[model samples]
Target: MSAPLEFTLLHPANLTEAVKQMQAHPNARLLAGGTDLVPNLRRGIGAPDTVIALGGIDTLNSITETASHVEIGAGVTLAGLLASNLPTRFPALQAAAEIASPSIRQAATIGGNLCLDTRCRFYNQSQWWRKANQFCLKLDGDTCHVAPKGKRCHATFSGDLAPALLVLGAEIRVENAQGGRWQPLAQLYNEDGLDHLTLAKGDLLVAVRFPTSETRRSGYLKSRVRRAGDFPLAGVAVALTRTGDKITDLRVAATGTNSAPLLFDDFADVIGQPLSDAALTQINKRIGQAIKPMRTTNQPGLYRRQMVAALSKRLISTLYEQGAN
Candidate 1:
């Protein structure tokens, strides 16, 4: 039988206190909604000596908007954001949030989703199941079952909001014992699954900021096996601006297709061109080539790759049509 899990829970009064607590407990795990961490804790995936709960920090749960951008605190619930004017301001984000079930949305926070753990078919099993299979590289063992001879882990990132935020050019604010720094959300991830987030020890995700413009038309599309409560098999998020049917600005990003959410900078070649059939064909081809899908989910890698191409095409085409009308 496995030993029972045990940990001390710390509730900091505010962001400042939270940082101090995190610094003091270097080996602690931050808990926002406990949706992901609790389950992982039970399975012994992360057995921290302390669990710091950020839910008590009020400032981290508010949303503030400026003329240039919208700042969403890390503690803001998915349901809270969806209920706010964010839906009208950033419809694509709202659509992505709605993809999760209403129950999860009610309890899951934006920060938790952004900092979700990398998942693999071989790694997410229960303790007994994993032990029986001799454990993969992400856990206790040395061999990577997914890529036996490979040097690194292949667990796939499965965040829903990351691609949408990335296409919007979102910035993340992280705080630690020394101070805080704001960086492009794209820089916060690494392709390696074992050490996926680029955050330093004791660094806490504070908020997410992204520019908002009436001229931008955006959309998010996800492919999943089930209609609800399933992490995306593959997903795409797109934002673009058009002037009289000529594309002026374009950003494309994808998630659930790789170890980290990816920004398809190669799609920039489509800028200044209309969304014509030929142009879309070229863009779709680029997307198919750019995404590196792995067999981390129940679906095959080939099917996920195809879905990425199809979803990218659909999102871009839908946004173009909507912008035209």
Candidate 2:
């Protein structure tokens, strides 16, 4: 890959200034931890005329707690999140925050991870390679290689934290030129590979709020070709609360197998059911049904679905055991 194309970089000292810069240059891509954007730049994925660097904004790096929730700033690194006592309150997030290598975790922000670009074998290649392939639906080309007759792209979203946060009932704080608003973390993403994030032009993700609870027990697990530094072939996160050996609240979410992080629907319907073999089988079936994996990675789509189901059952069983005892 070649060096990133030349662009003017602006450092905003405050959130207000950052928002103004983004508003002024609507096409300017944001630079947070630079873990993903920089690499994409080198790959000729985007060539923004201006880049707004958010690392200079102190507010985006703080972690604060209220009686009901804990707010983690968007710029806080994955390592920073794991270091805080907040992850102790949500083990699934803590587990997910440790993704990739130590150095990568130290530089990758939750915001960047959440807003990670959708990926596919056909799209994430170098310029010459993509050009040779004649491009894909996500970029210069009109055809979707994954489904030649279809009109949509099938790039997968591989972020590890989103599924963890999704099951924990997290909400994000979004700000733009107009002002700020809070939306459920689940609402931040859509299934489309080309435009996965629901964020509008100039919208900046400020922070995420995790609702506090005493009895929730959660954990996360991933399947990959390597033990470290590999994006998950399939990842699952489960959060549940037990009441006298019956599951009180159960939430399941997964990543790396779909265009958007998936939250298993009808999970609430199983509330109050005993965590038994039948329950596990039910969850496994739901996971198999929900995962819509395309051939974005080396692994087959059916393999990802199977691995995700197994990972989900294993994680839910473990959490249920811990919550039961």
Candidate 3:
């Protein structure tokens, strides 16, 4: 067993109080759902001297829809999102919420999902298991089991919500001891898995905002090892506008294939083209060509690459049908 953690739980009632506590205790960590943190703590992954619990912060637990977008509080549970009326504004996000189990949905928050720690076969082990391996770079040792010659950690960023948010052009609101600010969702991610989030040490993500738009259709498709409650070994989120059967704009994002969600707009060229099997096959090939998944998950990179194209086609097809509906 690991040594006991010398930590204090500070319960704050509002954002201001939470910010103040975090400022005072820079070494402390914010405890939201603890769906992830608690397991990590017990496994000796986190050693924070204090924990700021957001359970009392009621202000951060609600979701409000605006005229042009939806504001989801950081503390809003995944179950809350799934149970709430699915927002037509961000369909891909709704699909992402459906990917997790019901119990986990009730406990996991959107903010936690966005800031989820990167995962790896070697890094997720317990201290005892790591000790057996003589410690990997993610924990203590100098060597990396994932890539012996590589200097960087190749832990996979496995969050399902992030890719959806990326396609929707969402922005994140973050608060810290210094102040609060907002930025595009893409800015919050980094290509390096060791420190996946670009958030500062003092920053806390307060909310996620999804902008509203007309004439845009979106969908999410995940290719996992299993059908129910399985993390996507490869997934795609596509949002685009169809103007009289021609794609006017497109945003394609892929996850479980890179350190951050893979995004590009070049897919819009398929607009104005017919949705015949040949056209889809050509477009699918283009998507496959764009993504070169690395060796990281249960299946090899090639299998994931194929899945990416297949799922992308499915998502696009579904989006087209939704547009008709």
Please tell me which predicted candidate would have the highest TM-score against the true structure.
2
Q: On residues 35-130, what C-alpha lDDT tens digit does candidate 3 reach at each position?
A: 778777887887988999888888888888877877889998988887777545567877646566788788889888888887766767688987
Ranking by lDDT: 2, 1, 3
> What would the TM-scores of all predictions be?
0.96, 0.97, 0.90
lDDT of each: 0.85, 0.88, 0.78
lDDT measured at residue 313 in model 1 versus the true structure, 0 to 100? 81
Off by over 4 Å in 3: 1-6, 87-89, 276-292, 321-325
Answer with 2 or 3, whichever has the higher lDDT. Answer: 2
User: Best lDDT goes to which candidate?
Assistant: 2
For model 1, what is the C-alpha lDDT against the true structure?
0.85
Clashing pairs in 3: 246-272, 247-271
| Clashes in predicted model 1 | 0
Instruction: Find the 10 residues in a row with the least total lDDT in model 2.
Output: 89-98
Model 1 residue 103 CA deviation (Å) reads 1.4
For residues 151-245, could you state the per-residue lDDT of candidate 1 as single tens digits?
89989998889988888789999999899899999999999989999998889999999985544787788888788888888888888777778
The TM-score of predicted model 3 comes to 0.90
Clashing pairs in 2: none
